[model samples]
Target: MAASKIAIYGAIGANVAIAVTKFVVAGITGSSAMLSEGIHSAVDTFNGVLLLVGIRLSQRPATAEHPFGHGKELYFWSLIVAVLIFGLGGGVSFYEGIQHIRHPEPMRDATWNYVVLGLAALFEGTSFFIALREFRREARGRPFWQALDQSKDPTTYTVLAEDSAALAGLGVAALGIWASHRFDMPALDGAASVVIGLLLAGVAVLLISQARGLLIGEGIRPETARAIRSLAMQQPSVQDVGRVLSMYIGANEVLAIVDVNFKDGTATGEAADAIAAIEQQVRARFPMIRRLFIEASEAPVDAAATA
Candidate 1:
């Protein structure tokens, strides 16, 4: 966990500095779009920092009071980052766009603006690609965002989402900056900023939804359910599987409650042995599973019964 956070911290530091430079350039040139991108980068810095804090706190060892540890703090803090992105980045960009429409200012030192914008674009691209490479090694089979969207681990997903968004934002900013200078239409820059704002807001909404699911103890993926059910049913002594309930207890880790039904003729102690054996098998197959609590039932418990 500590190792994971180091990279995020580096990214945050880079973004904060990049944002400062972006704002300085934007202010000198009076380019609304550059200003919007600058604000967006600042929000990125905050999000990255918050993600680090969340990931750090979540790694605390489980205690008697927090049997589940502080893992949920990652989700809570990541959600807060999302809210900040929306309220701060999105809100400011929208207002700037509206302001530009009513009383637009002529951009100055446009040549200098291009140089600064180009450097910022390169920095953003480097950061974005680094994030993609980080996840690429693990996300080969899964689509780019699919793993992130379905991930239960808050810290990991937040970092991935933030990186992806940063890359996209840079591209948007580049277009806005170029169009504003190319066509001598400064308003286009502000329009691009507005579009970037919408994109950031969309990402924020997505982050919040994922966090909400974790907070409310969303069920494990269907594939997880099937994996649990199929594996338990494979046990020789198991007659049936009653129900399998799984919840994410850490980033990509799950705790499962499994009900196993053995033959009615079997002794209770024997059934207990069967359940224990099945649990061991489950752990062997799914190492990411952190907890497995089995309920031995002689007769199978149906889905309705468990519900």
Candidate 2:
């Protein structure tokens, strides 16, 4: 199966288990942080399912109403997931935290909180490890931040981000629990919930920013664009390669528009042949390019060289 799917499934399973355990413990101990953690895990679980559904929807073939295929479906759903995280997870946690702070309740049976948190940490840590390893494999030799920025496939990155946030939130929750128990300040538990909510909100904002770029048709990497331009210039009858615009239509799928300056006074038949040759070479060289549109024009400088 796809790496994204595997990661999603793993996260869903781990989060579901964690969420159930956390809710049970929260009910038993009345720890505000535990309840917040439960909500966070539940949101992560639902987000995983949404991502899977988005992937499936994105695989649909092109139709008259949507000629670019359903590839953008994934981006749309990803945005929705971000909104949900912010609205449902972060917003609710913040409200609960404030309520707890105003009317602080004594935490009972604190031992169960530790047991549940330890188990949750184990499960969240495993999921995070899987996501990090998969992301590392994808990054190859590129810097982790660079690879993350350039990745057109949002699945792995989204999962990685979610799991990373989960681990961090778990730490905060643990710390809050410990502080409250040691200092006999139950308000610390509520403060920890507030922190978790803020953390989730930050993650949601990052996801929204990434998804917005994808939705607005972000261009291909500079290196890939340059390679495509070089490929176009290799055509026999081509005089210069002009602007070559490209955008990702799906994970590993690109649509390119090549503007070419043909040799002056070239015959129509020869230009046609050159265009065909350019298309063939481009598709052959970059299989990820699902569609190519070549336009032959009059005198024009190579935009790439000037840039």
| RMSD to truth, every model | 4.8, 5.0
User: lDDT per residue, candidate 2, 1-307, as tens digits?
Assistant: 1888888999999999999999999999999999999999999999999999999999999999989898888888889889988988898888888888888888887899989889988998899888878878877789989888888788888888889988898899999999888989999999999999999999999999989988898877778778878887887778888877887778778888988888876667667777888888888877778888988777433544555
Per-residue lDDT of 212 in model 2: 93
Question: Per-residue CA lDDT of candidate 1, range 1-307, in tens?
Answer: 5535655765687688788988998888888877887888898888888888788788899999999787778878878998998899888887887687567677787786677667776776676656656665556589866866665665566666766676677677778777877888877877877887888889889888888888778777788678888887876667788768877767756788988777655655556666777778789987778788988766543434445
Which residue segments of model 1 deviate by more than 4 Å?
140-146, 299-307
RMSD versus native structure for model 1: 4.8
Clashes found in each candidate (C-alpha, N, C closer than 3 A): 1, 0
Q: What's the lDDT for all of these models?
A: 0.76, 0.87
